[model samples]
Target: MSPVLPPALRGLPVAPVISHPVGQQTTVQPTTACELPQQSATGWLKEDSIASGVLIVLVLTGVQRLIGFVRSLLFCRWLEPDQLGQWDVAWGFLMLAAPLTVLSLPGTFGRYLEHYRAAGQLRVFLCRTAVVCLGLALVASGILLVMPEAFSWLIFGSGAQQQLIGPLAGTLLAVIAYNYLISLLTSLRTMRLVAVLETVNSAGFALAGGLLIYCWQRSAASAIVAYGSASLLCVVAATGWMQAIWQQAPQICPAIPQREFWAKLLPFAGWIMLVNLLTNLFMIADRYLVAQFAPGDSEARLALVGQYHSARVLPLLLASLASMLAAMILPHLSRDWEAGSRQQVSRRMNLGLKLLGLSLTAASAVLLLVAPLLFGLAFAGKYQQGLDILPWTLLSGVWFGAAALAQMYLWCAERAAKACLATALGLAVSVVLNLLLLPRMGLQGVVLAAA
Candidate 1:
């Protein structure tokens, strides 16, 4: 017989439950009001399909790279070889320094943010790390402002371009903020937003920097200013959006203790910071060697660096793509690892490495085939030396991209220290090779060493 329903419950419809055989398990789908908030929160942080995520990143990255390539062509056309070389050195320094300044705290987001989110401490983690990153950036910027000449010598291989120090310092702060937002969004599996932000930054830089370079100053300083302005604007826009999202989010979970929080995060972040330093240093060491040790006057050496830069433009694009893939892949791998799907993580990583290797090799071949035409048409054949070494640069870039993909496994396993050691060894070898070869074979030797 049916039980008599209370007056308050009589008007509501009931959900039917079916009885099962002995030892059969029944699954209950929760439809209570209290469960709705939890479901919403889960959906907010749920991982996107890997296919969709990669597709979004690839499409947007391709667009961004196209704009960036055009910008590069314009810069190459407008600036003299030495002037272009100055910009390259300054730009590389900024890339290396921004990550270093913040001690790579943003890098931790991919591996740990999900863990924190599951524990209801995502906001706390984000806020604390952001404050620390900002403080470090401010301190680093202060140092740069106070000692521009010293850093100028450090970056340009001389103190004459000290004027750039001020611009670089300001830009570093903006870049730190920009990187933080990008990293945070990426870890949350918000690839579309990350791609959009990057596209905006690319478009802004190309439009503003091109105008400034062509119409106004026609110097590295102008490009620096434009970059900083775009980055700052992106940060401002992203922060506002994030604030609105956070306000609507349910925040009912108890916070994890500070001691436990730092205990897990700092070790991973420390190794990542070291690895980042070594990796950036490895990337730019060849250029620095050419700037400081190449057998020529400053003008001639810079001209050679400019030529090298042209050769590397396309090759570096491979590395950039690899980095994006690795960043996107890490979050998924971390989630799987956390869920104790360790073998599955390994299989996915293996498949990724193989695919990345093949794709990069094929791309390198195509780039090789088109090199001469690109040099003649786009570069106006001015960078003949760069054209000469295009094959070596392409090969180097392919290897580097593969290496970037390979390191994702290390990162996922919390063996970042091992990755750091490997990169440090590579950097040490690179330094020795550059030292030996730069004096002997000039730009070609440096290119070979990098390979």
Candidate 2:
């Protein structure tokens, strides 16, 4: 017998239900157009929209890169080759040391933060990680403070620049903090905000670093001071914004056991840390080889690094874009994987790789065509060696960028150790090549090894 329906209900048609086999999940199909899910006009703004996120990152990153290019040009114009070289090595050390100090713990944010958020444990997860990151950063800074001469030799290929070590350590602290905030915002799917912050950082660095370089000290130490100041300001602004967002969110106690959380998080983070360490080393190994073994005095080696830095200016932008894209895509991939949509994840990744490769190849070609003009006009023919090796550096950047995008799949599948291993092997090859080629062909050999 059919149940009697209310007068209000009687006017509406019912959705028919179909039976399924035992233990099978049943889904009812919508009977009317109005019953189906409809996407709102603002759906593109949603956190889950990968296309929108990518577009936002690309536009803002492009702007940031432009500003950074101008800043680099100004830096090259104002400082002598040795000073520029000093700045380059200092910058590389900051990049490599910050992630190492933090154990790449923040790298897990994209993959795991959403999982914890859904389980009402984001607060706990963030608190624990932040504490760990801070402790590690402080310890690293302290080590730098105590052993400045040792680090000076390791970083600068000479122990004479001990004064720079203190500033570098301070700047590293700021960088670590800034990177943590940026990673957190990215994992929160606030691509627009992250882009804005990045733009601000670049602009601030330009203004401050430029003034200090041109008007004040005309040295790398002053540039380091400017960088640290800008990073600190960004950190403060991001923290306030993040706090407001956090307060608005519902606070719920975590249900996951502490032991279980650590069990899952550490292993993944450890692999990511290894991967980051290896990747950083791989990227800068050439510079280190040139610094330490280029058959020159400290000043001469630094001058060579300055030239290398000039050649790298444009190529590294592509690598930066690749990193931004990879970071933006990882969360989407993780969500798809979490939803048991493995094939969908693969499809999206493959599509991204294809598009990125095509776009990068085109951009590289364009840059190559313009290389001579840029070297002649913008550089004032000051860096002839860099100009000569631009092609090799461009090729290296393109390939490295592609590799970074390719590793996203491994990251999504929790196979970061595999990525680490692959990068390790590549770094080994890079070292061997640098050793074999650097002595024979000079800076060109180093660029070729990187390529």
lDDT of 2 by residue, 1-451 (tens): 0111111101100101111222353433322322223222222223545677678768977898899989988887777778888998888788788877887778777566766665455667788888999999999999999999999899989988999999988998898888888777777777777778888998999999989987889898988999898889899977767665555443645355878988877765665565556666776788888888887899899889999999988887887777677766777887898788999998998899889888888899999899888877777778888988988888887787678777767766756457657877888888998899988999888987777
Model 1 per-residue lDDT at 286: 85
Give the TM-score (vs. native) of candidate 2.
0.79
lDDT of each: 0.75, 0.75
Compute each candidate's TM-score over C-alphas: 0.79, 0.79
Q: Which pairs of residues have clashing backbones in candidate 1? A: none
lDDT of 2 at 228: 93
